[model samples]
Target: MGQGDAPERTRRALAAAFDPVFYRTVYDDIARTGSDPLRHYAGTGWREGRDPAPWFSAAAYLSRYPEAAGGDPFLHYLDRGWRQGCEPAPSAHRERFLERIGARPHAVGAGPQAAPRAPDADLPAGLGRKAARELAATGFDAAYYLSAWPDVAAAGQDPLDHFLQTGWREGRDPSPDFSAADYLEVNPDVAAAGVNPFLHWLAAGRAEGRPLRFELGFRGRIVARLTPLEERVAAAAR
Candidate 1:
């Protein structure tokens, strides 16, 4: 990425905004190919109308701003489209999402949503234990959960057991990058059904490409997808 002037500036800004892990996790096909996520998106994925992140939809944005068709929709959004009140998703949904994000309480450990959850006795045996196990193997962070909820940590609870019993309904996050409120907000059905949001996502959402949380903490796992020569150039500059 030995770039200069306006193009390079945009590239770096987009790189900063990009989340390689989020891209790969959302699209298993991209992960399966082992291509650098940003490289793919910059080169062809965007042209294919693929989204760069969960919060931004390329095709949807393009539909709103056809003038942006000549350039990358993600770049355009970061560049100026958002200032123009562009939406990355359906207008109504995006409005709600923006309001939720702005409120901030929708984040970890905010307590059970306004809606109640089924009592512990009503939960199936090992409700989210399986999903929790699978996510742990993939990227779930139980320690993060405890850290977010001091009471749970103070009580020396088994992180998984507590989450299965009460933590989720209380809006406790299982992983730092996953927000129960964010998931439920986008997926009202999961919230309505009383199914574990994380479980529903793991068992079904992954295949469906349903939206979920992408915490700000892990924004750039691998966005700098420059070639080896470019890497050397960047390292030399550093």
Candidate 2:
């Protein structure tokens, strides 16, 4: 191929391997860390003595499974797809791919297996260990939740129960607070459509048949979306 053609070919190949979500994740990390994400991934420039062979090669291979290239499923397809450069596989096959890489598929609702019991012990008295552990597994800081809202505990309610029933229902800033309950409170027009907010969120996403980053936030003027615990739970149930 001609020299000019090489760059375009490489671009296409990389595009195939790394979807928008991959780029977004890298950019998000950069914003969060205030560092150069491309430098971390590919170095100075594509031709500035930084070897692009590995990434380009992986991209070429990943292009074959374009259907699995973005959002949540992208991670599931990445390693094996890069190494094997094969056609897309079913969920069962993907599970096996994880196994082949010495990894196990993550279980839904499974809390951190290694989190110390100390956090649970810090929960208000009368809350059971199981309930505390369940809240922690949901990815929120359990201790922070307790400390942030003492009134829930003072009423002798389980922290998780209060979170599901009330705390999440309260409104906050749109960015970083797009919980099902909060979203409904904020978007009364949507709520007026006469559907359950939580279910509507799930149904809309399902209809699109694509991964959504629900929790939105601004990092230095850039709007970023992230999947939250409530959405994760809804996804698991679906």
TM-score of each: 0.40, 0.24
**How far out, in Å, is residue 50 in model 2?**
43
Q: Which lDDT values do the candidates have, in the order given?
A: 0.68, 0.41
RMSD of each: 12.5, 17.6
RMSD of 2: 17.6
**lDDT (tens digit, per residue) of candidate 1 on 112-183:** 556455463233335455545555446557778778888988999988778866777788888877778988
In angstroms, how far off is 45's CA in candidate 2? 34
The ten-residue window of minimal lDDT in model 1 covers 214-223
Runs of candidate 1 exceeding 4 Å displacement:
1-81, 84-140, 214-238
Q: Which of the numbered candidates is closest to the native, going by highest TM-score?
A: 1
Candidate 1 lDDT (Cα, whole model)? 0.68
Predicted structure 2: lDDT: 0.41
